[model samples]
Target: MTTRSDPVPRTVPPGMADGSSGGTVPARRRRRQGGERSMVWLYVSTLVLGIGLWWLASALGDNALAPTPMEVVAAFGEGVRDGWLLDHTLASLGRVLVGFVLGVALAILAGFLMGWYRLGRGLLEPWVQFFRTVPPLALIPLVIVFLGIGESAKVFVIFLAAFLSCVIATFQGVRNVDLTYLNAARVLGAKDGTIFLRVVIPASMPYIFVGMRVALGSAWATLVAAELLAAPTGLGRMMQAAQQFLQTDRIVVGILMIGALGFLMDRLLLVAERRLTSWQEVR
Candidate 1:
C-alpha cells in the first residue's frame, strides 16, 4: 500500500512566538477586567460619599430629605419581610409586561402595514403622528373616564406609552430596509410576504430591538406614573403611601428598587439584543 503525503503544518501567527504573547495580554480581556474594576471602585466611592453625605445631613437635622443608607436598607428589609415591596413590585411588573407585549405586537403589525402599503401609510401616519405627540400620561384622565380606575386603565397607559415609541421605531426600521435587497428578492420570484419575512424583517430586526429597549423604558415610566395616580397596588403606590406617612426610608427604598429593577431590565434587553443581532454586530 502506498503511503499518502502528509499535509503541511500551518504556520503560527507572529503574536505567538514570545513568552509575552497575545494570550497572556489579550486586549479584550484587559479592557473587560479594567472596566469591571473601574465600575466596582466607582460604585464603592459613590456609596461611601452618599453615606457620608447622609450622615452629615442627618446630623444637621433633615432625615426627611436625606435619610441614611442604613435606614433605607432596614426599611427595604422590612418591606420584603412584610410583603409590602414584593406585592407592589410584582403587580407593577405584571402590568408593564402585559402592556409592553401588547404594544410591541400591535406596533409590529402597524409598522408592517404602514411600511409596505402607501395607502395604509397615508391613512394611518397622520393619526399615529398626532397620537405620538400626545404623552401617555396626558391621556390619564380620558383613560380613567373610559376604562375606569382599574387595572385596565393603568395597563392602557403603559400600553400607549410603549406602543407609540415602538411603532415609530418599527416603522423607521421597515422603511430603512435596503431597496436593493428587496429588488434582488423580487427578481428571484419572491412574493411580498416572502420578501417581508425573509429580507425586510431580518434587516429591520436591529432597529426593532432598539425600539424594544426604548419601549421598555417608556413602559416602566408610564406604569409608575399610572400606578401612582390610580392603582391599588404597585411600587408607585408604595412610594405614594410612604409619602403620605412621611416614611422617608420606605420612599428611598422604593426609589432604589425601581432604579435597580430598571437597571436589570436594561441589562437583560441588552443581552437579548446582542444575542439576536450577533450576525450584524462584531463578535
Candidate 2:
C-alpha cells in the first residue's frame, strides 16, 4: 500500500510542459547567433592584423615600392577628387559586366549541348580543351590583330577567358548529375524537356554557380591584359601609367580597387547561390 502510494507527479520544464520544442529552438537560435558573431569578429580581426602588418612593412621598407597605407589612401582620395578614378572604375566595370554576361550565356548553351549529347560532346569538347590549353594572354596578340585593339578586342578577350573557364565546369556539372534522379523523373512520367527543366536544371545549379564564380574570377584576371589592348581609360591602364612614372601609391590604389571590386562581385554571387540553393544541404 505504501509503495503503491504512487510516484509524485514529475515537474516539467516550462517550455517542455506540453512537449513543445520552444526552449530547444531558442537554444539553436542562440547558437546560430553566437556563431555569426564569432565570424564577424574573425573577419574584423584579420582585417586589422593585415593592416597592421602592411603598415609595419611600409615603415621598415621606406621605399617607393612599399608605400604606406596612408599614402595609398591619399592617392585614392586624390584620384577620386580628380574624377579620373570613378571614370576608370566605371569603364572597367562596364566592360567586365557586358563580357561576363555574354560569355556566361554562350557557355551555358554550349555546355548543355556538349554535356547532353554525344555528338555535341565529340564535336565541341576537343576545341574547348584545345582553347583551354592556350593561355588567354597568348591570345591577346591574336585578338589585337583581329579585333584591332579596340573596345571590341578587350571585351572579346574578357569574354573568351570567362567562357573557357566556365564552359568546362558547366559541362562537367551536367554530366555529373545523379542518374538516379533522372531515372526517378522518368519513372514519374516526366518527359525529356520536363526533366531537363525541373530535375536537371535544379540539380545542376550548384555546378553552374561554381562555374559562374570561376568565370567571374577569370574575367577579372583577364581584365588587366584585356585593357592592355591600347586601353586609354581603365584601372589597368591607370596601373600601367603609374608603373611608368614610379607612382607606387597610385599603383597600389589600383590594385586595391580591383581587389575590392572583385571581392564585392564574388560576394554578390555567393549570396545569390545561397538564396537559390537553399534546399541543398551544406556544412
Best by lDDT: 2
Question: Residue 83 of model 2: what lDDT?
Answer: 98
Expressed as tens digits, the lDDT of each residue in 117-230 for candidate 2 is 899999999999999999888988888788898899999999999999899888988999999999999999999999888987788789988999999999999999899778
TM-score of each: 0.82, 0.89
Candidate 2, after superposition: displacement of residue 244 in Å? 1.0
Deviating ranges (above 4 Å) for candidate 1 = 1-65
Best by TM-score: 2
Per-residue accuracy of model 1 over 1-283 as CA lDDT, tens digit each? 9786998787766666554465554565587679979988998899889778877778788445667777888888998899878998999889988999999899888887888789979988999999998999999889888988888898889998988988888889999998999999999999999998999988888888888889988998776788966678898998898889888888888788777787788889888887777668443
Report the lDDT of model 1 for residue 155: 87
Scored by CA lDDT, what does every candidate get?
A: 0.85, 0.90
Clashes of each: 0, 0
